[model samples]
Target: MKTPKITIDRIKKYLAEGKRFDGRKPEEFRDLEIEFGVSKKAEGSARVKLGNTEVIVGIKMGVSEPYPDSPNKGNLMVTAELLPLSSPRIEAGPPRFPAIELGRVIDRGLRESHFIDFEKLCIEPGKKVWTLFVDIYTINDDGNLLDAGGIGAVAALMNAKIPKYDEENSRVLHDEHSEENVPLTKERPISITGYKVGDKILFDPTREEEDAGETKVTVGISHGIISSMQKGNETDLDTEMFGEMIDMAEKVWQDLVTKIEKFIK
Candidate 1:
């Protein structure tokens, strides 16, 4: 739903002074909480809450023939479902544009960052490779589901245990898990978003604040390096503003990694 013009004006007014209704700094994020083992049947699963926004991610593994281009590497698939129960803005039906973009942005980040050792997932040089499905479901949509889902994805992957393969039958034994875990490295990529309102850029806006913003940028970063970035809401920005957003992303990344590293490690 669109925000009321009066409310938008009030939000922009507060942003111009570097203030918000919630009394947080423009560069500050809401409280973050992560929970593991949400699904006993899934190879890995986690639930993330960013303030009031909530998302759950599950990892399911299978065996498949390698893709022609990457015959030696395994495959990663990311999908998202924005349930109507999560918010009134979401409908119960096929994925809309936002859901598709969310998955793609997260996938591009994880894929390009080389967070997973795909070579280790390959059971055979050119024939058999493990396939991982990262499924994200929104339980609430106060705001910032994209970043929350990304965090949940990484945490779930970290928690995943590879399932046993029935090589003789060319299938995966979902009921049985192997001692081996998903081949992931120490790299923990995080996604941070900056919302633009007037001349101010803010992180982790509430739903009302998000609705009031003109546009936003989401960056996938690991350490100080950026892996992927996506802009949304059809607003134009200059190079200087983009640079500022990058700076904000890096700082926010550091802040978040500090809070989540204990669980990740």
Candidate 2:
């Protein structure tokens, strides 16, 4: 069922008073918390919290042949599952469109940004290469699932440890005696999300604002470049508003990136 019009009217009144229904300012965001390497079973894992919304990401690396089209590049796969346990709205079984879209967006942001050193994952060229699989699970659905999932995936990837391989045989070997945990390279990318509510904007929206937003812009900022961008809703955005949003995003992105990166194991 949709939110009652009376409730929305109250929210509007609150906004006009420079307050949020959840008791936050127009530009304030909910608290964020992160945990890295939370799972021992996976190669890497992380848990992220944006207010009440929660997400878990796991990274698994294995030996596989590279795709024919991009033989030189290692495989990187991202998938998101909206667990029915997370929220009553989530259906059981296969992933829904929203989950798929979230995964694809995060995947595009990382891959297109060249955040991971795929070339370094190559073992025996096209014959064998390391495949990075990132699995995102929604454990809670208060709101802002997109940002939570994206940050979780990136954190998990950063915390991942590559498996030991036998250079002599060109295969992943079971040599516990000589095994070593190959840490990821030095560089990592960061992402930022901005929401446009009425004529105002905010960084890292709260659960209430996320649900109330008329439009949003998610930008992946990495290595002095705009790695990726996703715009939601058909609401028109003027040049001035767009510029203001971008400016706010950049300022907040610096702090968000620092905090998230610090949790990289």
Candidate 3:
């Protein structure tokens, strides 16, 4: 939807005054809620709500041939489906650019952070290995689906279980009686996106604010280190503004990680 010029102007005016249309501080994030094991069929699942935006992620495990390059390690795949019912902007059809981008961004954060111990997932070196599939669905699209989706994906992975593999039969046992928690690294990585609007930067922007913004930067943080970064939109941020954005992202990363840990535990 095309945002009205007046609305964009008003948002900019509010930001200049160190305020937001939603009455939040520039660095503030909206209320967040997380629920785990939302899907019984899924080996692991989580539902995350940030303000009005909501996303659900499910993790499924299976045995498959190891990749040629990573013969000793398992595989991970992330997919996102933007339901038309979630937003007017999305349409019913195959995965579009936005959905693909969302999945890639989340995948990068998880993979770069090395959150999962892929080597341990190897059922048999260079032969059969455990493959994890993370599926994400948009339930609502008020704004900032990337961060919400990323959170859902990570939370779901943390909740996931490793299905028992019957080596004798060369088959995966999907029954509830034969399952164990998946192994993961001690560090947890989280993604935080900052939106820039006419020299003003904010975290976790709403749909209207995001539509009115010029550019956004997504940073992945793990163990107090940046694992990955991605910038979106055509607008260019000044050097100083870019540094400030990174600092802001780092400041908020700890709180987000703490919140997710609390929920998943």
Candidate 4:
């Protein structure tokens, strides 16, 4: 793919002029669109679009024996895949470094926030537990997949319904007449990632700006508190910048949380 020289130059010029290429003011966010239940077959799923970037997240849950060390808690697993077919630059194969990095980042966000509430997932104390597996797929690598994927995954998990377990039978009770459904509790985490380019910090960067970014940072905020942080690809930020970004992220996170909460209901 030919990198748009004009696009790069335009953004660069904007930076030089103390402006942004997209004409939005500094600290502005792109138009966002989110939907739950995008996948009909999955127990729960969500799709998030930020500008041209798009990501889809799905959650599948099952019953399993609790680990010896954490007999009373459940398990939460997260995986991320960047489909080569989604972007020309990506190649088909085992997940490359980017895919792995994306997975780890999201995992930190959820785990650090105590979002899963594993203790509550315990079905039979040391015998059984609810395992939540969150899967994220990049259908389009426009930009900001981390934020989109993170939000999508959390939203999907919030809406997921667990099937009843029959510990005596050592199986899940999926029979329509006998199966029971469970919903996640109210204490869940939400995240929003902001990108800093030049002197401006933006809510969600488009593909072009992302490619030109000097540094990228992902922040996870849960219930109005900062939970986790991950910085990747580039780094030139100073202490002041970091503090400012955190403040901006706190505000942005609240707005996103409000919207995502609606999907749960």
Candidate 5:
């Protein structure tokens, strides 16, 4: 949906005063909620909501031959679908640019952080290995699907359990389950996205604010380190602005990770 020029102007005006149409401060984020085991069929599943924006992620595991270069490690794939029902801006079709970009950004955040111990996923060295597939679905698009989807994916993986395998029969025993959890690293990665409007920067922008914003920066943090970063839209951000964005991202991530840990635990 195209936002009227007047609305854009109003948003920019409000940002100048550190206020939002929803009465939130420029740096304030919407309420966040995470629920696990939302899907019975999925090995692991979670639904996350950031105010009105919502995303669901499912994790499935399968056995496959290991990659030639990384024969000792398993593989992970992430995919996203922005359902038309979620918002008018999204269309019903195969995954498009937005969907692919969202998936890749989230994938990079997790993979680069080494969040999962891929070596533990190998069923046999240089042979059979576990492949994890993360599927993300957007249920609502009030705004900031990237953060919501990333959180949902991580939560789903945390809630997942490995299924029992019958190596001799070369089959997965669906009815059996492993008592251990998936191998994961100590660091927990979270993404924080900042939107630039005029000369002001804001966090957790609503759909309206996003429509008015000119640029976006998404920073992924893990163990007090930046694992990855992605910039979106066409806009020039000076070094000072970039530094400010990362500082804000780090502060936000500190708070968010605490909440996520409590929920996952």
Candidate 6:
């Protein structure tokens, strides 16, 4: 459901003062909490909460033929479902644009950053390769599901174990896990999203602030470098706004990554 104009006006007034109802700075994110292995069946799973926004990500492995171009490398498939229970706006049906966008964004970030070592996942050159399925589900819609999802995706992959492969049968033994973890690189990508409403910009906004947004800029950063950027909504932004967000994203990554490091194993 759309936020009422009255609430939007209140958000704008608070934003003008560089304050949020939660008392966070314009560029500050809400408290983040992560839980690993939320699903026993999945090879890897995580639940991440950025304030009231929450997303659950799970990783599953399957054996599949390698793509013609990347015969020696495995594949990555990212999917997201924004459940009807998560918000009043969502409906029970096939994924809509928002859910589709969320998957693509996270997939691009992971692929661009080379977060996973796909070559290592190959079972046989030009034949069988491991395909990692990253599934995301929204449990709440307090806003900023994009960022929370990014965190959940990374956490789930890190928490995943390589399911054993039976070479003779060319099958993935889901019940048996290998001792090795998923082949992840040293770099990790995190999504930093900025919302512009009226004359103010906020990161990790509440649902009301998000509904009042004129535009949104989301960037995926790893090791102080931006891997991908996406713009949402109809409002056009000038070069100055883009520049400001880049700077903001870089700085935010430094802080955000630090907070996430403590949870890594």
The weakest ten consecutive residues by lDDT in model 6 span: 256-265
Stretches of model 6 off by over 4 angstroms after superposition: none
lDDT of 4 by residue, 127-212 (tens): 88888888999888887788888888777776666765667787765432222333454555665666667766666777787766
Tens digit of per-residue lDDT, candidate 6, span 1-265 = 6899999999899888887888999999899999988998999999999999999999999999999999999999999999999988899998899999999999989888878999999888999999999999999999999999998999999999998888887677899877889999988899889888887778888888899999999899998778988999999988887888888888888888888888884
All candidates: CA RMSD (Å): 1.0, 2.8, 1.2, 2.5, 1.1, 1.0
Candidate 3, superposed: residue stretches over 4 Å from native: 177-179
Q: Is candidate 2 or candidate 3 better by lDDT?
A: 3
Q: Residue 81 of model 2: what lDDT?
A: 94
Candidates arranged by TM-score, highest first: 6, 1, 5, 3, 4, 2
TM-score of 5: 0.97
Listed in order, each prediction's TM-score against the native is 0.97, 0.87, 0.96, 0.88, 0.97, 0.98
- lDDT by residue (tens digit), candidate 1, 76-105: 999999899999988887899999999999
Scored by Cα lDDT, where does model 4 land? 0.75
What TM-score does prediction 3 earn?
Answer: 0.96
Q: How well is each residue in 1-265 modelled by candidate 5, as lDDT tens digits?
A: 6888999999999889878899987777889899998997788899999999999999989999999999999999999999998998887878899999899999989888989999999999998999999999999999899999989988999999998899999897755777768899887788789988999999888888888889999987887798889999998799899899899888888888888888877
- For model 4, the stretches where C-alpha displacement exceeds 4 angstroms are 2-6, 16-18, 173-188, 262-265
| Model 3 lDDT tens row, 1-265 | 7678999999999999998978999888888899998997888999999999999999999899999999999899999999998999888999988899888888888888989899999988899988999999999999899999999988998888877778899877776534578878986778889999998899898888988889999998887888888999999889899999999988888778877778866
Error of 6 at 134 (Å): 0.4
Task: For candidate 3, list the clashing residue pairs, or say none.
Answer: none
Candidate 1's error at 58, in angstroms?
0.3
Question: Against the true structure, candidate 2 has what lDDT?
Answer: 0.75
